[model samples]
Target chain A: MPMMLDRRSVLCGGLSALSLAALNAPALAQATRLRMIWWGSQERADRTNKAIAAFKTAKPDITIAGEFAGWSDYWPRLATQVAGRNAPDIIQMDYRYIFEYARRGALAPLDDYLGKGLTIDDFGKPNIESGRIDGKLFGINLGVNSSVVLYDKAAWEKTGVTPPSMGQTWEEFAENTIAFGKKKPKPGYFATADASGLEPSFENYLRQNNKALFSADGQLGYEPADVAAWFKMWQDIRKSGGCVPADVQALDQQNIESNALTTGKAATAFAHSNQFVGYQALNKSKLSLTAYPRVGKSSPSGHYLKPSMLMSVSATSTNPKGAVDFINFLVAKPEGVDLLGVERGVPASTAMRDQLTTKLDDVSKAMVEYIAAITPEVGPLPINPPQGAGELAFVLTRVSQEVAFGRITPEEGGERMVTEAKRTLARK
Target chain B: MALHSEILSKEGRASALRSRGTFRRILERNAAGYIFLLPWLLGFFGLTLGPALASLYLSFTNYDLLQSPDWVGAANYVRILSDDPKFGAAMRVTFTYVVLSVPLKLAFALAVAMAFNRGIKGLTLYRAIFYLPSLLGSSVAIAVLWRQLFASDGLVNMALWQIFGFEGPSWISNPDYALYTLVLLSVWQFGSPMIIFLAGLRQIPTDMYEAAEMDGAGKARQFFKITLPLLTPVIFFNAVIQTIEAFKAFTPAFIISEGTGGPINSTLFYTLYLYQEAFGFFRMGYASALAWILVIIISLFTAFSFLGARYWVHYDE
Candidate 1:
């Protein structure tokens, strides 16, 4: 019986070895593969594939698969993939969602990799700290973006209003917009793009008022009156004929490519510094960036340095180290910066930024120089707002629409916004 | 030896009888068929049943997807029903949408179906064309197209200006008109109900029409007395289903309003609001409660339909 058992064992082992050899045939035939996912336009996609071809030349052992989408569709797709635990090893993460993903054990902490000298720090303290959450770093800033005013240079020049200087007050800006709007023909043009909704408009207002969206403990940073007053500013702007109706502005957000500003209907549009790449990719017109007008000459109140976007490794990833290496490459490698261009933002790392800046076209270079020239009255880096932040944005938009349409008095809208905002905060 | 053989035969017969009895018992036990349903039973237990039960349990707790669910008894339900103004507003919006849109859609569908029932030329092509909107209406492309048509500078405004010398407000962006646009969309896709009515109209016996004509009934009289009475069952079915669908409408409002339910959340339907609570706010407990409330509302409406059927629905049986 013992002799028979030995013979059977040896025969089974030989057969299993043959089966294993068959499985390895496909792996031997194929190149080593990695997947990367990002959000961008066609131009960025073309550039990315070009960079992938470059990477393949350097490391013949590796090949990459790419997935891309527009800005509106990107985050939701990434979030769904993360939830399903089938995330791409490389992810394009945004700052607002970074803390939430990291805190929930969805992101791999990158401290060990950073300690191995894989981080870029000379960009500024604020730029690097925005990537850190709860003493653990989950993602690296892909680029640096501050909100800026994007104006059609030709349109402004045509209207005979010189572009406002960086230090102009909000009052001065509004007055100039009103004067400029009067020269445009019906249905083809307006002055400033409509304020997106109350919260974004209020974010600027709060900056002017020296307030933030939340306190250190994540509470409402201002009273309902603050909401109403801010919403009223939009009303005032629209009423003063310096802005388009709420409907037209609302459409701008739905399709930035089709936005009135891009179509030359409006002279000015509000955008993150990163958005110039998308506009330039689609439109023929030359565009330029300026700061949010300084309220006073001494008002240290311009846009803050924000995490343009970040790349985080999923906690459930099988290859955490590989994910970290890839993220480090995305932020710190010249090739990665060249591939991404200004789609993410201007590169946060000084070395990578300098390497990519020469390759950028005229519009992108304008954005980079605009950020460099700002006098840096930047606000505190944005934290992930409370859990109900999306709801907060929706409610703010609703009330702002009411104010814009004259359906609700600004005071009434404010009271309503406070009630809803508090309710959202309580749930959080 | 012969006696021994006979005894063995008798023992074999007794054993066979016992086996037969067991088979009979299985045949008599109704649940024996459940073994054949094992695959569905497993899926229901693993997927649908588990989540349905879990959602009910979660309705009493505070749950965000990232964190472990925390028990809070009836706190979420209480807050949603009493303290939350959005909840009340959402309910009103949903109710108004269902009540206003369902009957109008059904009536239009029946009218179209009647027109199509005549021996019209190119009947199949016309039917396909009429039904195409229903098939495509829920698609993201159609929703985007709707946004473009109703936007301030959209095709509709262009037409209004070209024809009437006046520019129209943005139908999708204006709060007063956003809900109406959704209703118009619902009405536009009335093909499913129209098809059902066409099928019902075919089921009515031609002899009844002949008999009604012999009894001196006019076309209108024949429709009221015979065709309408016979079509009640189909009408009732479509009504119940369409009402439930209207109550849960989301996409047009979501896409057209850009998920804000603007211009002042006047187009904020209940399910959209519920989704906002669940996914956007991460208030899973509250969303669960809201979902259960929807289930109750739908069930009550369904039950009311069944109760009302005795008076209006005429089954061929």
Candidate 2:
């Protein structure tokens, strides 16, 4: 056996090393291989890989390897890879993260490639602009989405109360919720989630008053009084039983299956437009989407279509050109968008998106229609959230949870938010 | 006499050279053995020691993953000790989890082990059945199952309502109950130490128990006299192992809380918080400092356990 091993090593090992040397030689370089990564459910991964397979067929030499993980695991792994200078050639980005990465020079600029190897003619102007940072296109918005409130249609019908409309004021929403909440058998369910601890609601509320979550200088944009009033509104809603009690509702925040709408603890819950289908899958109730409670009289509805998810090239990519080519194919190729459909969000290609509408499943079509109705009213997208904007949601969640628990008043919560946001945003 | 001593010294030098030659011969003969140990040795140095020392250096720097680390001296430690409420909360949660889990797990393990030691039928099959949990309990599937089982309208609550005629809280999400549910899950996987206890039980000779019973001692007295004294070492071993494991608990809490350590951070184990700082917030330097602090805390507990062991452990038995 030892003699055989010696013979094998002598015979194959030297040849193997020779082959490896050949692989490393610049003259013998093979395909421009790229590693692309994203985080989502199995459906997104499946659709993404399918698009990739088609891209492989179109540009056979520019090969792409797909990698993915669930949301929480993806960031840490991606960060480690970036730190180690082994980041994937391309990564799926988020609105909150685009600035952090693009500003830090972790992502590559795609501005030069646009209209040359890549085309954005079919990709809408606002959608294309959403990915630009300081005039450099660091990412391509995969799809456009806006936040919406999802309601259990059957539950609303049973409540015997007049339901809310698309542009209902906060007061009107509260009154309608209380009427439903006061029905016999205690309604068993809340009218909606507490939503005090949710950042999107806070952002939209501030935006309704023409304020952003962060100023151009990266400071807290809204006045403390504005947030205080927002908190007080939720507090009033809770007092009227228009939502679940703070503690119970706090348990359901950001947890999909345990969310009040899915758990039968609420008739309505606030979620992204894309989440309506997911909520329906988890619950037996027939679900429908409506605009988030707006100012009713305001011209700008404080909602804007932002990239639900974005795609970016890593700064360390060896094959930047191929990476851009692959991304262009994913974004603009008819076959690619056709395979991806409305899974990520509403597709940016109006022609392809309109084509998808004809073949869409009921839930997906509803999401597309919901965004279409709200698009005209949405104000311009705010300065693509700030560098530490990803952390803002968590900080807001923590501070507002304190308010929900009654450990601090709304004013105090607002003050704490300012301090936390400043500290975090200062890191940028 | 000097000449004789010189001769002896020369002989000794010759023998020393011969011994050194023999040592080299032994090394040559044992090359295969060394090759077999290579993987473990490499892992010990590369995966364990390398990262540990690197983290010690990293703890002194601001190492956000995207950017290169900048030296911050003692800033991370000072911040953790002074103004970080989340750190305090994480420490409290960890201690509560560790303190509650280790003892309860051992107690459950000991009781089940004693029952199994009572000459029960199908011992091998029963042993395997009971040991299954320890093998599978730490898995992601089990954690997901735990989340579903503890939901407000889930199987556990439904069973309680049906059997006891009382409503149950959402055990997984309720802040007051969340940590304890994790504790219960930990206690449920007491199979490993139970197996160790079973082995310890087998070692105690039946003659000792028979002698105690013949002397008019009751069954309880026999257990106290012969069984308990001999079982101390196993108990000590199990306690130390379980305590260390408990301090490092992460996966279950991470899965159950869906990675945010939420329901108001009630389920945030120290490791989970360390993970959040390192990964979630991208504050690796603070996380490294937190990790070193955890090591010190665990070592102190271990030292205390050893000191206390002198009082109750009877190894001579």
Candidate 3:
């Protein structure tokens, strides 16, 4: 009797569903469907999908499809899709990519669409202007982020060593690292990953010393002596066994998850602050964030607040209006911001920042507070990197490895880097 | 057979003229067979040939993937051949890899095949167990496994320390040893070639071995004078295929190195570097140029093998 009832119920439900679909076919066909893509951890993707679900609930007329990928796979997948001229309606852009894509006319300009197709009235001027290429808006700033030193608080305690203070100098940090390494249980464990060619921290070091990675005209801005000095400092620490041996660290290829720090071979590492949250999630250790180690006798500040990632529309999107509306929902709406909180970084919109700061969790609140405290120390953001700028870090890593291995001296590696930098920049 | 010949004239005089669309006549004569072949032909033309031709065109241009390709003629080829240090390194590494891995893997495969060829119980089960790595190898997961196996604190080091009372260098990371680890990985997946060798071994008539035994030819003597000479054709086939496969090594290096081809570019296989140029650096034009060069190199190697085979490959014919 129960089986008969189940069969009858299934038949009746199927007939009603078919009739409903047949009745609403035209309306479904008329629905404005949009696609969006971004790259991050599963946590970010899940939070983002929830916000998009809210948008769906808020606007029944528009249907949205979403795709997300891990960081390493994202650029290749997106480039392939763009080359096929099938780019999604909305794309998540990095600060480094805005100029390249905008120059290529791949990103849609949002100047005319502001307050019409999209809304950025509440966004701060500095945040709004960052997306501009040649005085035209090409990306919408989603969040402002910066880099920090992520260290395991437990590791520090276990070593009986104090954390590097906020204004710790490079000399002091190296001494601290040596002390930390001495407390480790194993012979091979070190206090940190090798930091000679870690570009973000190296950039901060340069900036603190009144230099930048690239000049306004996209040339190597630092003197070879400056690069040599930076390399020498790390070389000294490496020789003192203050950091993981070069080959061991190179084994992991500087990926945050697999790096010596996360594998319990180090106490401190440099990463973007947004990644701090993700790092903590993977690293079961108690973690804390601090400013980049300062260059001795340099400026008081070296850090810059960077746009974590930005939202942009494809120039060739068929549903431009739908794309803008979705973008508007993501960055400007209360419902969306409520779900998103500060997962991306601190909100770029001033009002949203004020509203969400109090509601964040312990770690997220600490991230926001860390950024705010460092705000006074940070200088203005540097210009977006040039076309061939992406490969510069690789050159730095390759040659620095040579220095660590004693195949070349620091001075020679620095000169090699400068020469390679010039050759690389010339291609742009 | 009747239908196949029916399409041709008795005197075959039609071959002198009206040769255009001749394929259509042959195709129509065996329409059922043609229908059967349509899927493979479609795959060849649409999937393989189309991209291959497109890459040829791209090789002559400067394409950044973000913008339309700009024609640059021989500029890409000139740059890769002359200016790029990593290109030379990758070529050196790939050639070294192929030269070392091909001979080692084939030798191991043949040795194992001979071992299993003796009358052994559960022969089928032994063959299956040995072939498992060939089935599962070359996948990204297996590459990841190889990385863990060779890690500083991984099983390899543990074994070395416990059993040999020796410390192992980081196999996958140390610049001096990274390429050799990948070669060992290639050698480990010798099951496919071993199976082929086993088949070739089985095909040698038992009576020949009996005759050699009666003549008092020892095991090693028989192996050199009988087994190897007759198995040259299979050896040639396996060597050619393995060399080409080694030249295209990417996944193991990519997974093991985290796609950066690092430790001072020690494990930067040719395909990995090409992938980095095209996808990582957006230098599709240069990458396409590299791809074409790889094709030519492989083709030359295959041609060289076929040419060299005549003297050594003693076919029964």
**Model 1 ranges with Cα > 4 A deviation:** A1-22, A25-37, A42-77, A196-198, A263-265, A375-387, B1-47
Clashing pairs in 1: none
Q: After aligning candidate 3 to the native by TM-score, how far in Å is the CA of A379 from where it should be?
A: 0.4
Write the candidate numbers in order of decreasing DockQ: 3, 1, 2
Better of 1 and 2 by lDDT: 2
Q: Judged by TM-score relative to the true structure, which candidate is superior, 1 or 3?
A: 3
In model 2, which regions exceed 4 Å deviation?
A: A1-28, A121-125, A184-187, A245-258, A280-285, A349-362, A405-412, A426-428, B1-30, B214-216
Fill in the DockQ of model 1. 0.40
- Native contacts, share recovered per candidate: 0.42, 0.40, 0.78
TM-score of 1: 0.88
Tell me the tens digit of each residue's lDDT in model 2 across B150-214: 87768998899899988887788777788999999999999999999999999999988888878
User: How high is each candidate's TM-score?
Assistant: 0.88, 0.91, 0.93
1 or 3, which is superior by lDDT? 3
- The whole-model lDDT of each prediction reads 0.76, 0.83, 0.86
Off by over 4 Å in 3: A1-25, B1-24
Evaluated at residue A51, the lDDT of candidate 2 is 91
Q: On a 0 to 100 scale, what is the lDDT of residue A112 in model 2? A: 87
